[model samples]
Target: MELITLLLLACALAMDSFAVSITAGLSLKQFNATTMSRISVTFALFQGLMPVIGWSLGTNFAAAISRYDHWIVFALLCFIGGKMIYDAIQQHEQAHCINIYSKRTICSLAIATSIDALAVGFTFSLLEVDIVFSAFIIGLMTFIFSFAGLTIGLKLGSIFQRKVEFIGGLLLIAIGTKVLITHLLT
Candidate 1:
């Protein structure tokens, strides 16, 4: 793919991570640089690594991967999004307890958000694209977008407070649905 096309693809792939980062930011009581770094890096790493892994797997298994990748993504996002909504509603009093910083939570969110990128990597392999270059662009774009999303979400959450978590949860579900619909339609 052309560099411009690859960059655009990177942006497209990063949207989920962007949305999830926003949710993470919204759920936090305060912004911590270290925490943001961890979140962004984790997301970037997954977004970057998945494609390489997929490319390594190559076209031989693309059929197998594609058969269920969307479903996995949809399930993960829905589960996490539902949990966020439930927590927001059930523990409104203790809203600060949402642990967005935990390793497990971060990893889960990263994986959930980056699953499509795996498919993209497979596509790259089929198209004979340079996996290293494509993965780098994808990871870099995700890192930038994820960081920005978190920052913006923190500001929005601070202003909106109580409603932000619910909104964030809905955003996640929406992203997941979009992914599922796009894949099925295409």
Candidate 2:
């Protein structure tokens, strides 16, 4: 694919990570560089790596992957989002105890948000596109968007307070639903 086309694809793929990053950011009790870096890097890595993995898997497993990818994403996101909402509703000793900084939580969010990029990578394979270039672009775009998302979420959390997690949780579930609906429709 052309550079512009690849950039557009990257942007499209990064949308989920962007939103997820925002949700993760909403759970932050305070600003922490480690949290931002961890979230951004993990998300970028997953978003970046999934495409290559998909391209490598190529056409052999495309049907199998697509058949259940949406479900997996939906379940993962819903579970996490639900936890966030429930935790937000409950009394947290620290106001924000969602543990968005935990390795497991971050990985789950990253994987849930980046599954579609895997499908994109599969498409790249079929189109005989440069996997390296496209994957790099996707990763780079995800990093930028994820960081921006975190920043936005932080700002929003500061303004909204107390309900940021609730709203973020709703958004996460919505994103998951969107993926499920989109896949089903297609």
Candidate 3:
């Protein structure tokens, strides 16, 4: 992929990390660079790693699914994005005791949030893409966005957390739907 396209893809991939970071910031009593950095690094690493795993897996399955790759991407992104939107809407203001920094919590959250990227990585295998550059860019963008999201949560409070999640989820679903529609139309 070209630099611009890779960057755009990176931005798209980072939205989930950003949303989760915002939630973490809201839940924390106070935000610090150390906490933010930890969260960002975890997210960035997972987001970066998932695609590599997906790409590797895709390499094995590519020939079998080459014709349906776009649909697969669309389904995966939409499933994740739709779930986020639904959760944002359905979630009530309840006390969450799950500490974001705990290893167990972080691991689960990281995996849960980055599942879409796994599919993206798979899609990358079927396209004219640069795995190293795209993964690096996605990781970097996720880190930056996640850090900023923490700051935004700290400064703004939870006022926008649900709204942001809703928007991010909607954006992902829309992107997936668009891709599916375009592919089908063509």
**Would you list the C-alpha lDDT of every candidate in the order shown?**
0.72, 0.71, 0.77
List clash counts for every candidate, in order. 0, 0, 0
What is residue 168's positional error in candidate 1, in angstroms? 16
Where does candidate 2 have its weakest 10-residue lDDT segment? 157-166
Model 2 agreement with the true structure over 1-186: per-residue lDDT tens digits: 558657655765666667566666787767888779879989999999998988887657546666676776677556656765775576544433446868998898889878867766765665567888888888999999888778877777533333545664565566567667876997
Return the lDDT, model 1, position 115. 79
User: Which regions in candidate 2 have their CA more than 4 angstroms from the true location?
Assistant: 59-98, 158-186
lDDT of 3 by residue, 38-146 (tens): 8889989999999898888888888898899778878877877787788678764542344766877877877877888888888788764678878888899989988
- Candidate number that wins on TM-score, 1 or 3: 3
Candidate 3 TM-score, true structure as reference: 0.83
lDDT for 141 in candidate 3 is: 92
Give each model a TM-score. Answer: 0.65, 0.64, 0.83
CA deviation > 4 Å runs, candidate 1: 59-98, 158-186
Q: Name the weakest run of 10 consecutive residues (lDDT summed) in model 3.
A: 91-100
- Which of candidates 2 and 3 reaches a greater TM-score? 3
Task: Spell out the clash pairs found in candidate 1.
Answer: none
The predicted structure with the larger TM-score, 1 or 2, is: 1
